[model samples]
Target: MSVEAWTTVLVILSFIVYIYIGWRSRVSDTKGFFVAEQGVPAVANGAATAADWMSAASFISMAGLISFLGYDGSIYLIGWTGGYVLLALLLAPYLRKFGKYTVPDFVGDRYYSNVARSVAVVAAIFVSMTYVAGQMRGVGIVFSRFLQVDVSTGVVIGMVIVAFFAILGGMKGITWTQVAQYCVLIVAYLIPAFAISMLLTGIFVPQLGFTFGDIVEKLNAVQVDLGFAEYSQPFANKSMLDVLFITIALMVGTAGLPHVIVRFYTVPNVRAARYSAGWALLFIAILYTTAPAIASFARYNLIDSLHNKTVAEVQQLDWATKWENTGLLQFEDKNGDGRFQLTPEEASNEIIVDRDIIVLANPEVAQLAPWVVALVAAGGLAAALSTASGLLLVISSSIAHDVYYRMVNPHASEAKRLMVGRVMVGFAIAIAGYFGINPPGFVAQVVAFAFGLAAASFFPVIILGIFDKRTNKEGAIAGMITGLAFTIFYIVGVKFAGMPTWFFNVSAEGIGTVGMILNFVVTLVVSRLTPPPPADIQALVEELRDPTHHVPIALTDIGEEQLD
Candidate 1:
């Protein structure tokens, strides 16, 4: 069968499974909708967590970034892995033991102020919307190529699919569907790697034998011959300081992400949460370690295929023309030589390829089987939809649970809350779809913005709330506002407003590290100046942070006594 036929069959089958899981796992009550009733097994929850975190960013954009950026792209791998560890060791157990339904819920109860909760809720929605835009864009890219549709139509299709499960089953449905998604995405990711590894280097092990000894040397030589720097050369495009800052931004951003943090709350207890986190790290590694190998293979293949080829010659290649239709891959013969040539200079470079398309197009570039190409299309959608669903849930939950029920109408019914949550999902999907069609940047860059925002707004407050008993509502509220506002100003001014990189030549993506530092300083200074939190809240923090407190923290007891 043709690639589209295979993709339609596989994608439809995957969607059917996801829809069925959504139906089977549907929840009416707020608890199940918000946190899966806190009953998920560690292993299942771990897989779901892995799927939730490894969005289109990891699946579609990470390898694409690495393929183009070469050595500089390793920053994403380092930052994301380090960030997960930070959350696993420092935040997960404590947050799970606190027994909250959402991050805003924790902020509200911990700080003893609805204002603090409200701030966290807004930040959650902002960050989620920004991140969801990337997922929706990924969906657009995959469908535009495989299904032969425009990017806008593809985004609408994705929005509808995500809304179905997210509105009906909530977290309960999303969790189970994500487990299945993890399986599909991982299989889809690995099979191509195995095939391409064997084809390129005659070795099936990508990580161990990825152009292992001499293949890299050959690839590097090809790069140099084309007037491009060696593929492994460090700081080819960005400065060292920028790399450090971007890495730190991504790391703390991962720790502060609301969707990922809520995964721990779905597990039964602190121990289960801890176990799930470790398992998730393992699952994430399987994809991550393979990424560089894929990047290397993709870069080499790309250079070999198009370096000195004419547009007409390249168009004869089915994959090249198909991707060209998506408008992401373009060429211009500036010198009228009738051939596209690769070069380091922007003025003479004939090809303008969107880095986002590299991974999705990798199979076709390598002439893998039709089924493999179609399977990759399905995997891209799976990765995009999985994270998109999780993010939509976070957005709805923050508004419905955090703001409406907790703050606006403390007496709302469970049914009413669920309805509001579903309604909010519709609104969020519409907004996310719009951004997908008109994204500010490519998939990975947009996601990096979201991460930086999360690092700036949520990381410091959550850290202080957990470890410091003296942290008060005034401090948290002030810190969040300061950090978030500053970060947004810098990102918008630089990215959109053409504001120069003023702070030590740090780009917008890396400015989040500075925002995080400001948040920490402002929080500490404000906390010392203001009165401390109430004695009960202080006791709760101390208890959760205790070295020997492995069991649950008995948050219900504290809630009964002082929180209400």
Candidate 2:
């Protein structure tokens, strides 16, 4: 079969499987829609969490980022993976034990104030919107390239598919579907990586392939010959300070992401939550380890393929022309030479080629079979769609459940609330699709800002709410406002005013790092200055710590009064 044929088959199969799962697990009540009725097994929850966590950023763009940035990319690898440790040790178990449907619910009840809950709702919406826009863009990119459709058409297709599954399955459908998606996406990601790694380093394992001394020697020679920094080493241009700060920011931000933390709530108990984190990390490692190999292999092949090829020759290549048509790859015959030169002189001034193309274009560059390429295309779509649906659900729930039901109408009917949530989903998708079509900047950069916001505003408050008995509503609210204000101000300042040229002299990468520190400090200071939480709030904390006291209740069995 042709690559396109194989791609069609895979995508069709994936869609059918997802729809079947959704149909099988369709929810009739709010509990099933929101928390899967807290029945998800640890293993299944782990897989779902992995799929939810590995957004378009991980599946489509991380390798590309690494291909260009070299050692600096390790920050993402370590930072993201290491976050599971924090989740496992500090956050997940307690949150699970708390037995809440949303992060805001925990905040609202623990702080004894609807205002604290409202603050969480705002942060969740902002983070989810920022993240979802990137996922939609990923869907558009995959569709445009592999499906031979325009990006706008692809976005529409994606929206329809997600709406169908999410509206039907809710959390129950999404969890099982995401487990399947994790399998598809991880397989799609690792197959090409393994092929490339074996071709270049004669190793099947990408982690070992990267460290193979013989391959490193060859890459070092290639780098020196091309007048580029040695491939085996870090970039000379990147400052040590920048690397440190970026790593810290990513670590904190990973811990802060509400969508990821919310997964813990689906598992049955504290022990399951801990085990689920382990499972999530194992799944994530499958991609993270292979990603750097894809980066190394693709970078090597890209430079080798284009090094001395004529413009005419490159234009004749199928992949080159295809990508050029998408405006993702561009070339210029600088120095008036007919042959393309990929040295620093050419890389510095040519039209900007998007980093996201590295994974999409890798198989073609290696001259691999078309089926491999098609599988990658399917994987990219799966990654984007799965994440988009999850984010949309969170956004809709925040508005409908947190804002409408909790604040606006405490006596709202279940049917009315469900209708409101679905409407909110539709509205959020439309707005997010617009942003994806005309992205303001790099997808990853925008995602980082979202992470920064989460790290600054939500993570600290949630942590304090669970662990500290003395953290009152006043402290939590003040801390959230102060942290959010400072972080946003700093982000805008640096983005517009150019860093002060002296503040901490940390690398610009440390923007999130600084924001996260400010959040933690403000929370601690405010909590210390305020009165202790009410006696009932302290009791809630005690209840959260004792997993044995709470029994799992099926959604169909739980009453509306229990939820309230």
Best candidate, lDDT-wise?
A: 1
Q: Tell me the spans in candidate 2 whose CA falls farther than 4 Å from its real position.
A: 235-237, 345-348, 492-509, 546-564
**Candidate 2 per-residue lDDT over residues 477-498, each given as its tens digit:** 7777776776666666776677
Please identify model 1 stretches exceeding 4 Å from their true place.
547-564
Deviation of model 1 at 76, angstroms: 0.5
- Candidate 2 displacement at residue 551 in angstroms: 5.2
TM-score of each: 0.98, 0.93
Clashes of each: 0, 0
> Would you give me the overall lDDT of model 2?
0.78
